[model samples]
Target: MSEPSRPGPARRSRLLRTARRWTVRLVVALAGALLGVLLLGRVEAPIGPFDATVALRPAGGGAHLDIPPLGALEVDAYDGPLQLDLQLRRVDEVRAEALATNPVLLDGVVDQVSEDLRDAVVKVSWMTALAAVAGAAGASLLLLRRPREVFLTLGVATGLVAGTAGLAAATWRPQALSQPTYTGLLVNAPSLIGSAQEIVARFDAYRASLEDLVANVGTLYSALSALPAPGGTDDTVALLHVSDLHLNPAGFDLVRQVATQFDVDGILDTGDITDWGSEPENSLITAVGTLDVPYVFIRGNHDSAVTGGLVAAQPNATVLDDSEVTVAGISVVGTPDPRFTPDKDATGDPGSLEQSGEELAEIADGLPEPPAIAMVHDPRQAPPLDGAVPLVLAGHTHEREVTELEEGTRLMAQGSTGGAGLRGLQGEFPEPLTCTVLYLDRATGALTAYDDVTLGGLGETEVTIERTVVGPPAPDNGETGTDGGTEPTGTPASPTG
Candidate 1:
């Protein structure tokens, strides 16, 4: 008779159903509470016009001072504060509240805002956890009371929350968090009010200086175009020499402007067109193709075989590495720098420089006619070609220099035309941006006269143009010519501005 009291299948089934119901309800409640906390999280809103002038120095020892959005500001002397306007458009509730409390000290305001944001985030996180637990308990109780309607309730709640979120996302337009306005003042230790006035005054001066610089550039261009030909020779050809462009798009505009102004017959580029020779960087070659004049290119240490191929493909460009080409009646030969650094850490083949020099020297020795100009990237490699070519032109050293080698050969090292090839932006003192206008004798195909134009040194925005004459190559006897010809020296003159 006692065996009749044992648990039956129906009883077991009922107990299992109860457990399942409690589990489902508990899960729904937990999920709903979590969703509630997330929905109640802090929202960012715009607070009315908030603007402050903050003085900042260079983060480290360098000439460039970065002002967000305005980019790095190149300063001649880092002895003063570069005042800039910091405008806050919209911020989270925590940040807005913090800013409202202490609007005086910029540093204090920033610190408070940061602390408040962290606290808000932490508070939301804890609330989310608590809500999740509370939601699980509440959902379980609701399911126990009305099991039939639980699914309908959950479905409606989910649809409403999802639709609301979707609509908000679709309609919401994000605005920039902050905007920086440059105020061209270099105050060493400026008071708050004094800084504002100085900023305004300096800003006005900066605008005027910019206008002057533009006017000077225009005047310089006009003068270059109108210059009289030496010895009244109409056969004289003007060639613009530039190098180490390093993907600076500004180089294109400057080159085009100079080429157009001077009626340049051709342009010689000595490589480093890109920092890294990647496929995407090949787009820069398009700018070269747009030039109306012939563009002669040779790869530098930074260039790759792929880059050379791309330059060769351009309609207006001729890749002259290890090759000869006649441009504007001047016989030109070029050899690309053999040292190839694929990445920053990868040093080029150590012996590539010597090998390349030898290869180029051999090519020069075998030339049918004396090349008017020999182009290479490294100056060290140029010495080998002495006496093989009349004039040797190279870059890599971002400084303008002209030196006569032991042989009759003359080496003209053009300064970087791309403003030291983007290294100028690294906050260090950058080499002055330079380009040369070479005037060649038509019959002789020899360099006659040249103009060296220098602009925008490191932090300086002034332009300087110097004119110099090139004497005929030294007498073939490996001795300085007894013809009494003097090597031309650069005569510096300030720009019109």
Candidate 2:
């Protein structure tokens, strides 16, 4: 046996060169494969009523779900070099129109939506797999030049994509969906997407309770609307006034029912929609969006910047912070509170209530057109605004009140729309949940009359509505009184819960 078979130095060098050349080729093929997959590893499918695209990309493993203008959400559901992204494009026009006509129809179509979603996923998977392989092979051919190299690279690419996908499937954690990070308007994704099973069970129960509460409230308002109006209601703009909801689910329900029944052009909320203004609390703001009417809001002592942002993010909402806006032919101005009393101690702006009130008055003065109404969370902030606007609306004391300022400005201080919040339950007697519907002359934008609707606390439900007509400006008296020279329009039959 010739053990003297050792190669010459030239042969050894040739071997090394071959190894280096193949290594470079392998690296290039892998890069090309990744590029191809990223460019074409996507497929469009019908997900429920939405036309959506599912794509695979070169990224830190996970999933990203995007719903255009509304926003996007990201979850770390899996681990690998490749990630998935789902985007909703155009929605089915017929289904969209149906939802627009009546949003409640959504609950009835849940099962169909789920089935469509599963079908879309299954379809997308096969399409994406084919796209990945074809893309990889095409890209490798462009770079490799040789048929043998291209074929080998194509096989390698297939294995790589397959393995990555398999790994993701094996490691995917449904729990990650509960803690997704959010962007844009979908900042409250957690409220909609919780963990699997247990969270789903809890959410279902909560939803059922909320629906029942809304149904009962809606029924009461239907009965109340049956009472005859005082006439001259035609050609008048109806506006719903709500404040101090304190994040009560029922509060939004009441607003929705009243707005729908009265056909109000807009909703004016004087703040304290949430208790702490925390991120979790912001989720409740979605209820405001569901109202489907223009919503104008201001911050209350209990609200924070977070609360304001959430409300403003709603497609139909406008946040007034030392600003003015017109809704349904009515001009309005509002300023945030000088203090944020999250606890016993107040915080935020160092300016006194007097100064804040003056600043608000100045803002109203600066507007292009004199406002029809001025809104403040606290009544103490209304004195300076007396002459700046014809009417001022406020809420804070948890009790409804009507007052005439020395400057002839008529003020209507609203009661808590949330029955003074959860705290109302602590009292011996149930506090009433109250709101006002303002009737304004379309041509003059003047407050003609308003109805004060008060309902007994969360569980109580007895409802009362008083129609009050305003008589011109209390003779500009120096003293402040609750009457404002307005007369009530006799008690009509009300609903009892």
Candidate 3:
């Protein structure tokens, strides 16, 4: 009877230890689950129509198109789902299936993969919990075994802590989980993957051509800056203002080097720093952090729609999405290009442009005073701001250096600061070769339109800035100059008030 009673006490002790071990495992699992949630929530999915325009066109089937670089997409009218086919090439078939079945497909491939990936994450969480439970059991057992085993068990726990912490930190941010764009999953899958040979060939061709254009333009911009200032002295802030450098670090590097070499007082990046609006730790952010000067940024159409997260991360950088800010003594009002109503299913109901000239007018009214300069995404959008503003700085066109607009209101098209070059997916490289537009003073109506030709060895051409009087000289003091003849004696054309 005494022997049986002794075994019962030992059994009770074992049961108690097991319960404590499970409790520890549960804590560890909870910790891992929370960490995964925090990291994934921040991941970005870039969405846009640029990729579609480049890779796909109307091939067949309900007038649909496909862009493999973006995804196998089927585009049609947005109102109703009609005849569709998404051949690894057609794209419509995939869209129709996705529409009828899993809407997650429309969310983008990343979202689809994430759903599958979640299970893996849960398994790892369970494993972590299990390890912690085992560790606790081991500890309890050691404590029970003898007073001296506590030291050994403590050593084991310390090693486990170091190992687990290091691994969790290392693999916390995954680049794989972040590649989905707004249009669809960028990753390759049999159901949607297209021709590899074609993609590679096209990419190679693009790369070579891009290299040539970049080299040429960099040289041109450098050359322009080297030109003697119109006035002997620098009248106003002469800084490089570029925007929409979507995730191109090489381009950003050039901008930095030019800024540093020229000793520009400020560097203003209008917006769209990343290819996608919400990606925080990619090449773009890494490069943006390297600049050691005051950098001002305004959201562009792509910036707000694709990589808006960069703005939130860099507090020192000012982000003027729908606001106004002053830089280098010039008050600037900034707005992204008109919004487009995207077809979520890749069915082509032409995207609607949602430009807010009225909103800008309202913002302009609140200005403490008239702004000397304004930065916008599209030069064509400048009309809505007629008479209210003097200068509009924009970059969507990526014109070689400067392409003057129709309005007397001077337009500055700051070429590619950096990102997939100006060719876009259509393979139309930046115009003006090695040029960027510059305006000396909006208040004085002084504008300098030329390419910066400084980046050597990038195949850049020398661009010259020649000023030609467009219309007959401003009405000469109410007495017009006779055709090709001298003006009225002693009557000079006074500056337009």
Q: What TM-score does structure 3 among the candidates reach?
A: 0.48
Candidate 2 runs further than 4 Å off: 1-29, 46-51, 67-72, 88-94, 102-105, 108-124, 139-151, 183-240, 243-356, 359-374, 377-380, 383-391, 395-434, 438-497
- Over 266-334, each residue of candidate 2 has an lDDT whose tens digit, in order, gives 999998998766665676688788777899999999899988988999999999999888998899999
Q: Which stretches of candidate 3 lie over 4 Å from their true place?
A: 1-184, 187-195, 202-226, 278-283, 338-355, 400-407, 419-439, 442-497
| lDDT for each residue of candidate 3 in 1-497, tens digit (9 for 90 to 100) | 35544557788899889777555544443343333323321211112211111111112212233344454433332211111222222234444455435534443554544553454334434444345435544544534464444344444444544555454445443342223222454332212322334334444454445455545444544544545443333564555677656555446656776667555655666555544343332424645655766566666555544444455456445656668776666676777656431211232111221245446656776787867666666665566665566566766555534433344455555655553332232223322222232435434533432224322212222223332222233464675543212111121111110
Backbone collisions counted per model: 3, 0, 43
- Per-prediction TM-score: 0.60, 0.58, 0.48
Q: Which number leads on TM-score?
A: 1
Question: lDDT of each prediction vs. the true structure?
Answer: 0.63, 0.75, 0.45
lDDT winner among the candidates?
2
Candidate 2 has what TM-score? 0.58
Put down candidate 1 lDDT per residue, 1-497, tens digits, no spaces. Answer: 45568678999999999787655654565466445544432223222222222222112211333333323333232122111112233234564456445435332543554564445434543443444444444564455557554654455445434543354345433231112223332221132213334444443443344344445677676655455655455889888999887775545556787788777899999878876676656756777887889999999988889999988888988998788999978998899988776343455554676677678878877888777888888787776788788788888878889887777677889878877544554433545567888888888887778888776643455776767766554566777753323466444445644
After superposition, which runs of candidate 1 have C-alpha atoms over 4 Å from their true positions? 1-213, 222-226, 342-350, 457-459, 473-486
